[model samples]
Target: MNYEDLFIQYQNLEKSLKDKTKLLAKLEKAISKEMEGGDISRCITDTAVMKSVSAEVTSLLQEIESLVSSFDGKEYIESGDFVSQMLEQCAENGVDVTGSSPNFEMFPNKVRIDVENQDIYLDRKKVACLRPVVLVQAIKKGQEKLLKASFNANKFASELIVAYDLALADLGKNPGTDLYLQKLYNYMVPMSRFRKDYDLQSYAFDLARLYAVGSSVEIKDGRKIQWGTSRDGKKGIRILDGNGREEFLATIRLF
Candidate 1:
């Protein structure tokens, strides 16, 4: 090779070495930070809807789980439309059953209880559309339990407002159907993780995996731990406790 060619080759080699060195340094720094215990990593955006949705789903799932644990699915049907009956009882007792819903397919039969303003639609009518009458009956029993519980009623009402609005938004836009699906799936996906005690980011990933809603998370130091979401502007989700550990507010996404 010519002397000039040799020098050019040497220069290229040098550049490659420098690039490799830089990447190595970055990897080392990341490893060091990881070893030293960096702040909790958040995997999602800090949106009010996201947080609210997560909370709602987790709470509902928890209720369903509790019911499942108690009944094992066999007792309710044997008892005959227990949930629907209970809902009727609530109506007779004059309790508000507005917006309380049951996953319809989970039941083998469907029992319709007349509620003011909104008819209780099960999972079959709502999403999966598998209207099993028995399962529907079980769902009625479950929903009746929910309606009777003051705590469940409050949470269900709040979720109903959000769900209805989101569903309406979905129904309105034809071209934006994908966006609506993303939003709905985003809310539904994180629910299982939240129910299982995973933090917001983990739940967010679940949404991404199921619904393909992608997002980035960032954290900064402040007087209080704060969370922000894509939909809302600069809303805080955390506060620094006296002990300095960040406490979550309405939402939490790790650093």
Candidate 2:
């Protein structure tokens, strides 16, 4: 089946499962009531109905799983035309996107879509479905429901300074030592607690914002961390945003 047909089938199967589940719930209550009222035949009938409906639900779930798992990479993930079509569909739906290959971000919410992995990340957590409309829905939900709270530069800088210091101390490195960008993310973002959801992707956005829009804190006498780019074929942290020219950040100098 084509992607559209597959998506529709998944939705229909889910609806059927939900209906069957509701019938099973009613049957459970009926069976209990009939048994308590000493209606043996009625209880037996309801129990049988419940068992049959439950079996149907199980079968539907297995079918759904099979349908989702059966798609080959050539049909979607590895197909050049499929990727293009997916992005085109999003643009037609009025979802502006950036970076046409390997990854794409649905703007103005920065919802990252990794086509290679077939994963959609909203805020730092993964969204569950491979549904094609997810690209549009992600932007809509970000605009309507998951609106972000204001980013606090002072709060983040304060926490980040501590994290940087702790990272240095833990590594047995001296003050003002250059730290790896990945090291900071692995060390700091996970160690500190924040009022809002601040995962690694959150770290990416926060750091990008700080670098692009200037932070409120000066770590030591106006000294702060500086990001360095890899020049000798070393891998760097890829910033997955569509708006900017800077793609990878490799090193950081902490003050």
Candidate 3:
């Protein structure tokens, strides 16, 4: 009915949208795990269900995006504007507006504008009072977390190659060298923990191939290459170029 009522309604809708988004994301992840069964008929049925859930999630996301866009034209008045409006209204009604009145109180310093809700309120009140800059920073931080959670090395394989090339060039040693490989493993361990199917030896060999010296090696057909050795005297495969020249491959340390 009024600006205050509309602002409250908008705030409630925003909160509801965020809650629904999180729930839907969890549901999608659960359904995806369930879809990995080996039964063909059941897999087909799961695919259809997944499609329905995905469509619903997409529609909700579009609605939320549209709602956020609509807020651009809405007026966001600061404390000064609020005070000026109150003074003008008081002057029109022949009431004194210079001094603090019994009915009206203002906390100029404590007042903050909530950009999302398009409302102003005192900081002392137990209510959401996020500034626009703070809200943007919060959103960016959440997005960064989401990005990290969904990280996949295959998605940034080129970037990894470039990083290895730079590191090798700067250090004047092959990335497959024992010292650099250990350093790389230490750096990657924390990030690799987030991966569901992470294998340290497999990743180490993959990294070995990216090294300038190891890039010339070719894998033998029907032969599984070992990346690390055991204390029982079992040795790992030696890399060889097309010209039959031996190349160095990193011997991973299990510890």
Candidate 4:
């Protein structure tokens, strides 16, 4: 064919292909709408089927929650002795201890609780034997109750309040630590910015735990330690190596 004729034919074919693609897209869209009961945005399913499935799922969830809630708090407390109680408490709190060693770790409220060599560690520091019990109680009371209790007590509550205030003051500073503050606020101020009632003991427990987790601390020879804030305003664990160089270990975040 002549060049002009060939070029015209090529243009016509391209146009035809484009038209066909458009038609195919329109057809597919129509089919999808039909399958989706006239709504292309939704999935194809019988309304009755969806309702039945939802009801079943809701029922199962309720049953599961009921079974879980029925558990007496004493099951872990009365398991065996102090060590056994600690282990049981860890298990009940979803902390796994089935590994090869006696060291076990759990993340509740994004805070790490490590049971190493049968000693409980919160924020990597060895804590009292009653730490687990207090932790569990704080969790049960909810975050706000824990925060209020923590703030009310004269313990390490000031640090958290200061952090929270600093976060609020800047609104863009230390975004990493903001997660921890948000978690506390979500628990303490669910609807409004003010809630007066709180559990004192639970607050104290939560304060100690948060302080241990969110504060910057030094690990010396992996034994004796000093807890304080760094000059940079970032909180994390710092371990000193043999060369006396400080190494960043990990930052505690709200999980």
Candidate 5:
């Protein structure tokens, strides 16, 4: 059977299993209430609905176990060869691949395949299994997530208002032409490296991409949020784009 097809089947079965388990729980609860009527001889076989639901739950569990056993898969250890293989396989399957060596990323959505660590990560949550089919599943999931992860310029601009407001408050709440963009960035994002949080880094990366793509930020309050360049001796947030060059955004003004 096709691995992807089998995986999809397995997922569907798992979902069905959950539904059956819930029905089984309801049956058990109902039985407990019935038993409270003082019938000592009553058991799980006492009613047709109770017996039917319990039997279905048992059959589902067995089928799931059998399906799992049929997947004769093994761990895919990371090596130089594994990286090359993934580069080809992932792209062939329509997931864009980038980065290099032990650490690389793929996406129609953001997923990190850490070859050295034998893991796949989305939003810093690790997929622990090193099974090759699991990687395929991850690629498919990345594609699905792409549909949901589109950049929302309006939401981002709204957050900018919050960050800008906090920066203004920090600087004594006086009327100013602009808030230093670096100050706003510091308020809005955490120092990921020091905090040991990859989610914060991911968030900062998304923000930097906005600058790279020249995305517009607008406030709904009839105010304008504008990006300004930093001149000599002015502090700025350097958006380092992995190719050895950087971009800067120094000031933001709301009027």
Candidate 6:
């Protein structure tokens, strides 16, 4: 694709990802609502909604897999366009090609890359991996709904927090839940910051105001966090950090 065409395609992909994300959010909300009123945890794992979510999730996973595997190079991570070629490069570079997400333990012969911590492991041991780049993209595609709930600066902030707390509590006793909770928190930090800074009060009156306008936060210098508008008149939210770009903790859509 030409530069313009590629750009357009990229944008289109983003939009498609966003749509899938909204659907996932709605599904999650349905599950959460059902669980909140009563105990449906057992039913949730096999519910139609959950199955649909899993299917959509699988599709999103494929997209992320495609995008991440498109690059294969020893010097630069973005070197190849084919997954097989990337695997060959990994073999050539002595970088172990481990099994990936949804099955971190199935393949024993290769190193394992854990999506929860964005880290790599060799035979159940930690290995040096600067993986925040791939992680940011993957999380963005897989957990859009959580990101939205986390980033909401409006009326849903309190409710979102409650739902998140419930999820953590419910999953706290379960080992499998911890990993997912960790991933959820990693993506929610930026969103939490937006809610905390953007809206001061939490009373009914204040909540009404908070609900009226939702904004985003951006980080500058990776330390300083700020909110407001962009140069092109896109009104949402942003933040700045003083320490420069930190690893991608989370991403919140401005629109």
Q: What's the TM for model 5? A: 0.43
* C-alpha local distance difference test of each model: 0.37, 0.66, 0.42, 0.41, 0.61, 0.39
Q: Which stretches of candidate 2 lie over 4 Å from their true place?
A: 1-82, 90-134, 137-148, 189-198, 215-221, 231-234, 240-243
Give the CA lDDT, 0 to 100, for residue 89 in model 5.
Answer: 67
Candidate ranking under lDDT, highest first, comes to 2, 5, 3, 4, 6, 1
lDDT of 1 by residue, 1-255 (tens): 122333455565556555545555554555556556742242122233345545554565565455435432333323334455545554554332332343211211233422332234432243221223333345557645633543332333234234434654656743222232233434443465554343333323232221211222211221111233243212322222223333332332222
Models ranked on TM-score: 2, 5, 3, 6, 4, 1
Q: Model 4: per-residue lDDT, tens digit, 190-238?
A: 4553433433223334444545443243222222222333323133333
- State in Å the error of residue 192, model 2: 12
lDDT of 5 by residue, 63-106 (tens): 87898777643233343444555566675665555567545544
Per-residue CA lDDT of candidate 2, range 58-162, in tens? 999999999878865445755664566667677677665666555565533455556657675665457755555665666656644422557666667767778
Off by over 4 Å in 5: 1-78, 107-122, 131-137, 149-152, 168-186, 189-198, 201-218, 225-255
What TM-score does candidate 1 get on C-alpha atoms? 0.17
Q: In model 4, what lDDT does residue 89 have? A: 67
All candidates: TM-score: 0.17, 0.50, 0.27, 0.22, 0.43, 0.24
Backbone clashes in each candidate structure, one number apiece? 22, 0, 0, 5, 0, 17
Candidate 4: segments with Cα more than 4 A from true spot: 1-45, 79-82, 85-255
Candidate 6 per-residue lDDT over residues 1-255, each given as its tens digit: 112333455566667777867877777777777777785874475367657766876786677667645533232322212233434444454332333332221111224544455445544556554333332233234333422454344335544344444555655633222222223333344366674433321222222223334333222222222122233312212221222111111211111
Output the better candidate (3/4) by lDDT: 3
Best by lDDT: 2
Candidate 6's error at 85, in angstroms? 27
